[model samples]
Target chain A: MHEMALAEELLKISDEAAASAGAEEVLRVGVGVGWLLQVERQSLAFYLEALRRDYPRLEHAVFELDEEAVRVRCRVCGEETEQAGWGFACGACGDRDVEVVAGDRLEVRDMEVRTDDV
Target chain B: MCETQGEGHQHRHLEVHRHAMEANDQVAARLRRGFAARGILVLNLISAPGSGKTALLERTLEQLRPLRVSVLVGDVETERDAERLRRCGVPVAQIVTAGTCHLEAGMVESHLAEVDQRELDVLIVENVGNLVCPSGFDLGEDLKVVLVSTTEGEDKPLKYPAIFHRAELALLTKADLAPHLDFDREELLRNIQAVHPGMKVLEVSAKTGLGLDLWLDWIRAKVGEKQSLHV
Candidate 1:
């Protein structure tokens, strides 16, 4: 459902970056998906492939996506958990007061472009 | 030919760090600024479908006397919700998202133009009935209130932690039916606290009028707090 919309956004961003750089071809685009966003990689990849037909510039671009672990800090015991679970309690003191340190964003991190000056 | 062609191209790497949700967040920030300038308090209500979001709002309009409030209702495809709220004698607008699961900030910014912002003290947005998709979006609301019905089970918050984690307050609607169903609220409270950690909970029945005063008082206090900031 919304995965298509998110995939379109990622494709648009990746293609636009390559287009603005005046690259003749795009090789790879790296993306980071946070745990909280609940975006499935399989659906996202499928949508990207299905939507990229419109963006000919990215016809063969490699969309490299990786997940970012949810990191949180416990308010009571001062311990940080790199991959927080659904329970959302402190890993140390069992306190529920935790603040998210990362894993709250989906971003296009980098891209590799090629210029064929023929 | 491969060697010659490969040599003709130059490979370059670009470091482009940009959030995919930046566009929606930008529009939300704009809406936040506009609401603040007008001294308006906006609340976005998120809940599962049929969890009584509209019913609670209907009661809100009926009970919160003298507070000028407007509603922006989001649904998949219907004008019926807006029509229902309009009967309460308040300006109501429907955001028909077609097939979209959630309402975006840009959609809200555009649809809200139809209503007069200057005349509003509070604007309640009943988000599309969804516990999942709506949590990822920000519609410039002063706070997000999540509604969970007693029938939904004790681990509703545990199952959908994202929405609960993001919400400021949780409303246990359909409270009048709790006893018959043998719903254990203590377990529900523990599950909610497990994820949200001290999030305020209110039990109310739109039909029976239980705990409506507490709900209204919370709104009144929030409205007063927002007004004092602009003053």
Candidate 2:
């Protein structure tokens, strides 16, 4: 539900960009999701499609999702490691007090718009 | 002339990279800012069904009544938790998910609009009683309390370590029934500590009022911390 709201905002941004650039149609929307967020891409896309249908300008909007893996910085050894699960321990020093430096992100990376005027 | 026009035509493609959830994060950040501005501490409670989350809140409400606290509960089916919390004489609202497994930032954002954040000191969101899914979503809360009762066995933290490890506090509820059941308190504590070492553990029997004061003190301190942050 929260992601749906975010997708709506992204769509609004895309719409504004299209209008500003004087584009007739928005072709694609590229997104980046962090591993820590663990969002359901399909569900977000489904909601986006439903929302886009309401806007004829985005009738043919395409969604592209890219995910980043979880990465943590070890507090004890100062070594950074990529984690697969919730295990935040550092592989080098076996430190459990590692801080997550990245991989909990949800952002709009890019979009594709057709600037051609019909 | 048609062949010349076709040869002269060029296609243009614009690359725009944007995050799909940026809008949701903006709203979530606004909620966090709202809570911070009002000096309110928000806690997201996650647990399995029948994990005694409401019972725990009912008991906690009684304990925190002197402090004047409020709650916002989330459930999929009924308003039973809100009804139960009303008896505590605090402002309570129930959010029914209808079919969702967890509560999201947007839901909390909408509920915040309905409730007056200035009137209450603490806002506890009892997330839709699912440990796995709720752990993945952020409701712009300050703390996450994961409750596991003795009847549920000690292996719960080990099995669902994602919620347990992410939780700032691990509450061992229903300690009064520990003796009646074969539930091992030490083993449970060990399991929780294994995942979250030095984690704040509170053993309370919301029914017996045992260790209720300790839990109340913790809540008071957290409220105080939030208040002091504003000051």
Candidate 3:
């Protein structure tokens, strides 16, 4: 649902970053999505691919997603564990009071740009 | 084709950081800072459409009429909720998101400017009734209060754990109907606990005023805490 908006932002960033770097064309964009965000990767890719058609420089550019797992640290045992979906219980100590340490990140990590200059 | 030693048509990977929700989160952070400066405590209320959010707000507003309080109601369509809150004799703003399911931080920040800061002690944002999308968004509120009624079943916490997990307070609304319905009170609390350990839970009935005092006291305490920080 909100993936369309996110995809739009991703394309805008790619175009701006490419232009600023003196690149004639964008090759690829790397996007990082944490497990916490409920983004459909397929839908995001579809939207990015479909929307990039409007940008000439991004015609061949593709957006790639690298999703990170949700990680939490148990408050009682101080053990960090990867959470599966909504489960936050610590595997070792079985403590429910786990604090989320990682995940929930949705950002553009890097982009590959090609310049026409020789 | 001769390639220069330092310069040529080469592929380069540049670190371009563009946060997906950076736009929204930035605005929310700004709003948080602004509220902190003004010594105002903001609360974002999220729940299903019929989870008694409006009812609880109405009751809370009426009881807190002596104090300065305002509300911003978010809906897909209609000024109905805003109009109802106006009867409480407090500043009320209606944010119609058209077809948008959730209210973003930009929306809250823009509408908040319309509110009179001098007369407002606390701001309560009633998010568009949904359990999923709103959980991911930060609306510059001091607390994210999630409401779930007994009729919705205890499994709601398990079904939509994200909302409960992110919420600072989980409110069980419509306790007046608990007698007529076979709503497992203990199970619901347990489910909420499982999702978010140490999260605060309160049972409030707008009709019966059950736990209204405690809710108001909590708000007062929050307001006092905010004001104390300013001092």
Deviation from truth (RMSD, Å), model 3:
3.2
Give the per-residue lDDT of model 2 (tens digit) for B80-197.
Answer: 9999989988888889988877888888877776567778788999999887778866788889999898899889987887688788988888889999999988898888887677
Residue ranges of candidate 3 with Cα displaced over 4 Å = A73-80, A85-98, B1-9
Give each prediction's DockQ, rounded to 2 decimals: 0.70, 0.36, 0.61
Q: Number of clashes in every candidate structure?
A: 0, 13, 0
Q: lDDT of all the models against the reference?
A: 0.89, 0.78, 0.86
State candidate 3's DockQ: 0.61
lDDT tens readout by residue for model 1, B28-114: 999999999989999999999999988889999988879999999999998999999999999999999999999999999999987
- Name the 10 consecutive residues with the lowest summed lDDT in model 2 chain B: B1-10
What ranges in model 2 sit over 4 Å off? A1-30, A40-64, A75-78, B1-20, B98-100, B113-116, B153-161, B179-197
Tens digits of per-residue lDDT for model 3, A35-73? 787777898898898888877889998678999889889
- TM-score per model over all chains: 0.93, 0.78, 0.90
- Each prediction's RMSD over C-alphas, in Å, is 3.0, 4.8, 3.2
Q: How big is the positional error of residue B204 in model 3, measured in Å on the Cα after superposition? A: 1.4
Candidate 3 C-alpha lDDT tens digits along B133-203: 78888888999999999899989988888788888888899988999998899999888887787889988
Q: Name the candidate, 1 or 3, with the larger TM-score value.
A: 1
Query: On a 0 to 100 scale, what is the lDDT of residue B227 in model 3?
Result: 88
Scored by Cα lDDT, where does model 1 land? Answer: 0.89
